[model samples]
Target chain A: MRIAFGGNQAGFWWYMAAGAVLLLAFAGIGLFRGAVPIDEGDVLAVLARHLLPGERAADPSVDTIVWSLRAPRVVVAAMVGGCLALAGAQMQGLFRNPLASPGIVGTSTGAAAGAVFALTFGLAGTFLLAAPLFAVAGALLSLLIVTRIATRDGYTPVTTLLLAGVALNALLAAFNSWLIARSWEQYEAARRIAYWMMGGVTDRGWVHVGMVLPGMVIGCAIAVWFARDLDLLLEGEEVAASLGVDIEKTKRAVLWSAAILTGSAVAVSGVVGFVGLVVPHLVRLLLGPVHRRLLPAAFLTGAWFVVGADLLARTLVAPEEVFLGVVTAFVGAPFFLFLLVRHESEVAVSR
Target chain B: MMETRGSARRAPRLELVDGGVERRGRWLLRDVDLVIEPAMLTSVVGPNGAGKSTLLRLLSGTWRLTEGKALLGGFDLSALPRRQAARRVAYVPQTVRPTFEFTVREFVTLGRYPHESRLFGTRSADRGWIDRCLDDTDVLALAERRVTTLSGGELQRVLMARCLATEAEVLLLDEPTSNLDLAHGLDLLGLARRLACEGRSVVLVLHDLNAAARFADRVAVLDGGALIAEGPPAEVLNPDLLRRVFRVEAVPLEGSTAPVFDFEPLR
Candidate 1:
């Protein structure tokens, strides 16, 4: 029943190198193709003009599109994507259940509810600060409620976590629908809400990047800090505690970090489902399940996946952008089914 | 190395005084007074519903004693922070249902969490202890496999190795061999004997009387949540006592090799 592989060091290094290369390649591709569709040389030239003191020889419009508009969007995409992946990884570890994702656990829905509530009530001079604050509060509230219900007698059952998530998701979805239905004067408000729920990085600005970056940084740091404890927790709390882990403390910290990451990502870009769910699995496939390796790779791979998906969203059929979440679903849902089938076959074979 | 030695030198002594634990207004155990010395293998034996596990939980600080105070070392068990208490006593619950799959090495390394740095890496000494624990429990061969893929016996050994990696002075195991086969059960008992022989205090809740009689230095019997008997096997094992305790007739067969029990009564 034991598998001993002697090439672990080589395999691990290769995986890390591959992930870094993929991330860089994807970022490069994303920068080169945009509304103006600058070639790789042109993009590098523009970057050089900004960095070096040479004469700026590019079209001003091209410069604006490449530097101001698209650069910020890509950076925001990477930030939000990395946050979602890290949050997903932490939630999966904290709940000790593979199916435990931010969306399924109601973290994304709660954040979306907060954002919509703020927008509906016109709570800000602008949508700058009010939206993310409401989103964070909503995410924290949902996290507390879910953990309270899921944990009983110092144990949280996987079944209970999923069931609570389903119930909370339904309730929040209904509330969001009600808000949209009740507000008729905003006209395109319903459309905007619907599109946001599908998720995208279009029209993302420096303001969007600023709002989500801090949360992403803080959340990622906390997740990495507790990565070892999370590995133990994935085995079980008793095992973790016997291994000298403060199980309750590790659990609470992981839950908080997951909420922060999910809330901030949703606040900036809306409910991008399944990136948090799918990216980790994909990374686990490429690299093994050591959290030391899994956490960083999942972060970088998720950033690449989201940025690439956004690129496809924008350029798939000219200017009208497709929903980023829709594109992810197109890629993720089928892969999920494939994984389920593959896992079933493996289980069957083991039996 | 230095850390383990320091903790051992300053290790806490445990004392329970007229202590009992209650759940839902029902006393699981009551009016118990006992002192658990350091570095002793205290095996608790009882029938079903005897609250042996509850007493272990209370002593390990997982449950509160309702009547009198139980102190660990000098500090009250209730007053100690959970993390600090965890460093003192390691509790292995009877049933563990892991919801995710983790590798055996990752699982064992978790024992170093309390001694870990904030950056989430283990020291060289901690790593040595972890590997030594795996070697002690004979689970070194399983260091790479996912724990979910392990057999029940292998999983139990892995768990024991996790406890060993903590390097705590006191080890509390609840029904450690309850779900294992004959071979694994014997292996576990041998490991426990070795651990106790190494001067670490070990406490276990056991179902097999023969295993307890063979391996444990001292045996404590719990009935109705009270310590009914505490002594060596020769003093604790009697046909009358066995009848009163387990409702089963046990006839002692004298032999130089080892004492054998012919269990009968129900049939």
Candidate 2:
């Protein structure tokens, strides 16, 4: 059953507006709070100077820091968060389970492995967008394998798909381990792989922003296009089929859409934990489970969440920044568990 | 508006010609030939594991038929695309575990899917038909409620509302009243009869023999994965057949339009 309505029937209206404000606030904080203690007005001035074709800000250095240094990370972080959350919502609808995220199904790790493979083999150095391309390819290939293994007679049962995903994760982990061992001879290669495993975008640039933009735009568009069909899918395959949904086509499209979203996000952000798993689920709890509203709401909620988390990562422990994945896991895990416990008890009480 | 559509809504003739499903060298249902006519309520009564659901699936063109053909309007049912077939047939499965927080109106609106295929279709296009469907099932009052918050009987009515939104000719309901109180069960059966009276072919998979005898214009009995007997309730649900197939003794009520069978297991 769906998570019980959390008593706020009007929650969705406020959520999007709140999300927009919080996202800008977090991003604004990110711009001003770094190595140089620039004022929030100065950051806005820098933005207005560049965006509105006005006079240069008082400090050229602050302009460089805000525009060149902090802005890319903020944009990339939003894209990563939005894509991951979109993927999460899509997978939950596709698999018909609240807990089925891209990370849980091994797609994110597979993409991380793909990026690591490119970086280790010097493919990323040869080309600008190679890492994300490889990641998308890896994601699609792994999803195809998982879907192939789980489907029988044109139907993919949920339990079997989950089990197959678990197995795929184990196999990918082993393969990555072998790759890391192979790359151990070269210190740079090993460090790059380890960096991808660590899951962050500390020194990320505009190139990284460009890498994940298509995945976010194309994936969200495709997912939202199939939003109605995904709603039908959550009902069941038989129900979807009876209602004019081409079951196999819808499943394949949704899987690919989720794969692209997770793959590209992982390519830039590495294995950012819980953004995909928790953001959409939480948004669904606050909003309803209808995919059209759910997907976009999840995207905004996730974007702000990670941007906020990035700010916390920077300011929480000054001088030494925490890993993005670590911050997300620390904050997200407990709240997810709280939701689980509350949902379970509510379910029991209703019963 | 209902009057205009009512005249044009004649249900197509559906026929199963030796059609059934098989799995791994075992037949779930075998060689079941039956003609379902519009303006009739047909109840399928059988003992447990007697393939009542399999028959419904075959009739609905869900499970692939391993034997012969199911025909609609003299064309093979399985050959038609599910979208086109859905425009003619709608099926309600045995158990509907409400999974989402969709309002009853939105839930029923999903049934209009077959008629629409646009990336950004007009949302209010099918509003009139949806409201009429809600009215037909008597759940128009509950249209604003979340489906997950509804009672079992209310949910059943909402499901029927969703099915009616399809405007399909044939509706196959699998044990629609299994969990309801007697009044709700009778009410649901009466609603099924109303659909039939409105020129739709309504097939119900029911375990309640007395309900079958009372409500069904025709009845089909199944035993051992085969069609054992079929005809009007009086002829199909006879005492000897009930004793043989269900091993129960059945006696008719004194004054009833149909034979209200009182069944007791044979000693």
Highest lDDT: which candidate?
2
Alpha-carbon runs more than 4 Å astray in model 2? A1-11, A39-46, A53-61, A125-128, A181-186, B1-8
Question: What fraction of the true interface contacts does model 1 reproduce?
Answer: 0.44
Clashing pairs in 2: none
Error of 1 at A300 (Å): 1.4
How do the residues B63-155 of candidate 2 rate in per-residue lDDT, one tens digit apiece? 789889999989999899988999889998886877777888878888988886657542565888898888877888888777888998888
lDDT of 1 by residue, A246-306 (tens): 7777877887888899999998888777889888876666555668777887888788888
Q: What is the lDDT of residue B255 in candidate 1?
A: 75
Reference-based lDDT, residue B76, model 1: 91
User: TM-scores for chain B, in order?
Assistant: 0.91, 0.94
**Interface root mean square deviation per prediction:** 3.8, 2.8
True contacts kept of each: 0.44, 0.55
Error of 2 at A66 (Å): 2.0
User: Which portions of model 1 miss their true places by more than 4 Å?
Assistant: A1-10, A51-58, A121-133, A144-165, A285-288, B1-12, B95-99, B256-260
DockQ (model 1, Cα)? 0.39
Worst 10 residues of 2 chain B by lDDT: B1-10
